[model samples]
Target: MTKIAVLGAGSWGTALANTAAENGHDVRLWTHNLNQVEEINQQHTNSKYLPHATLVDTLVATNDMFLAIENVEIVLSVVPTKAVREVAKKLATALEEQAHTVILAHATKGLEQGSYKRISEMIAEEVPEAYRSALVVISGPSHAEDVIKHDLTAVSIGSSDESAAKLLQKALSNETFRAYTNHDLLGSELFAALKNIVAIASGALIGLGYGVNAQAALLTRSLVEMRDLGAAMGAKPETLYELAGIGDLIVTGMSPNSRNYRAGLGLGKGKSLQQVTEEMGMVIEGVNTTKAVYDFSKMYHVDMPITSAVYQVLYENKPLRTAVADLMARPLKSED
Candidate 1:
């Protein structure tokens, strides 16, 4: 069985570790929280994150960062986007001899603000350059809650190296869990990061009591805008229509469990962004990705009207209805 190191104890991380263990892989699920480590090791559960879920008996959890990376061939990074670089750096220092020994697969789905660097870029900066070529990103419409329940899911795996992607495809795929491989790492990552912004916009529409038509229009337009921006940024145009883009957009925007969409709902219901974020108690990725998209659009000179309007509503205290009106009033352009 493959040895897997999951570098997070959140719901997604726990779910993936459980999946690996159930597939008969040895997993060392690492968390910064010692109490969570104890919960997984002693009780075989992560009640805080996955309340109704049970961990596989072979799954181990630990707070010792070094122990988590020891002799593992696959390092699955499931931490938040903001913490990715810091965690990767720590992993690098802790596993110097094993630097190029393990394959790093990350599932974070947001861009770095100001720099607009994707998670893979951040991982490349933190990990040794020799090992950077082995970095991979796994993304799709799968939600942590659903995945923990073993619900059927399809995910995409992308990497610069075709062999690495194929390896992950074999390691993570099952009859219920389907995996597809692509060499368009940048496109996959770009879609994963940008889809969150569209989800926020979709959520805002729902919160405003707008009907399905408006949500559908916003989602379609936002996706086209994402492709336009991704094209300018060297991504494959066709990738935006695939799982990482359209697939993730549909699920995250419409699903009630999406924290990003829920945060937008609160904003649409007249709650301040600060209040919504404070209540969520988790990182609403779209909030952070909004700023990233705003900056990236300017950097790429792509006209993303919806993203701009959503950002203004969230960050500039612009009223949601007013922003919608502004977007609607913009000059019409050819739908080329």
Candidate 2:
């Protein structure tokens, strides 16, 4: 059995920790919340996050970063995008001597704000040389809600190091869960991050009472937007055609389980961005990602109309219907 360290006790992090523990790994989850650590260790349930699911008894919890990473073979992080560098820095400090022996992987999906770097890149910058293994990105269509239910799920493990990716596959996969390796780290990470923006669009469309036809149109057009932005950012074209891209977009964009989608739902109902953020009680990653990608696209000279629309609605205070009208009113273009 492998020893795994999971940073962050949020929904996604706890679900993944549960999966690892269920797979017979010695899993230790670290969080800043002392109350949550107590709950996970004593009650075997993260009531706030995964109230419906019972975590395995073997899964442990800690508030101490040192204890979490001690002697672990792999460190898997599912923290929010904003916390990637902070968490990676903490891990580097805590890993000390063990850094060279452990594999570092993150399921966090979002780009950094100023640099617009993928989660893997941010982690690499902060944790460089501290980890001997290439940072691996574990992402795709899976949701923490369904994952805790042991419903069938599949995800892509993207790493430049093939062996590190396979090791993560062995450590995490089971009968109900599977991880496929994709060497296209950029593509896997890109689609995973950008799809949340489209998901927000998806939720907003539904909340605004748009029917399936609108949903269909949004998905198709956003896929084009995602691919175009990815190409300008150096992603492999084939990777965007795979599970990490198309598959992930379908699930997140359509599901109520997505926090980004839920946030958009509130926005579509004419709620203020601040109001929706307060109500959700979780980080809506797409909010920040939309801003980052909007800037990134301008830098790359890519025309990202859908992203721009979402950005306008969220940041510029553009009315939802007005943004929709703007998109529809754009000059006609050939679908090449």
Candidate with top lDDT is 2
Q: What is the C-alpha lDDT profile of model 2 across 283-322, one tens digit per residue? A: 9989989999999889999989999999999888899999
What candidate 2 gets wrong by more than 4 Å, as runs, is 97-100
On a 0 to 100 scale, what is the lDDT of residue 71 in model 1? Answer: 83
TM-score of 2: 0.97
Off by over 4 Å in 1: 97-100, 131-133
lDDT of 2 at 259: 92
Each candidate's number of clashing pairs is 0, 0
lDDT of 1 at 14: 89
Candidate 1 lDDT over 38-103, as tens digits, reads: 889999989877888887889999988789988888899999988998899888887786554678
Reference-based TM-score of each model: 0.96, 0.97
* Candidate with the greatest TM-score versus the true structure: 2
Range of the 10 consecutive residues with the lowest summed lDDT in candidate 1: 93-102
TM-score of 1: 0.96
lDDT of 2 at 2: 87
Task: Report the Cα lDDT for candidate 2.
Answer: 0.89
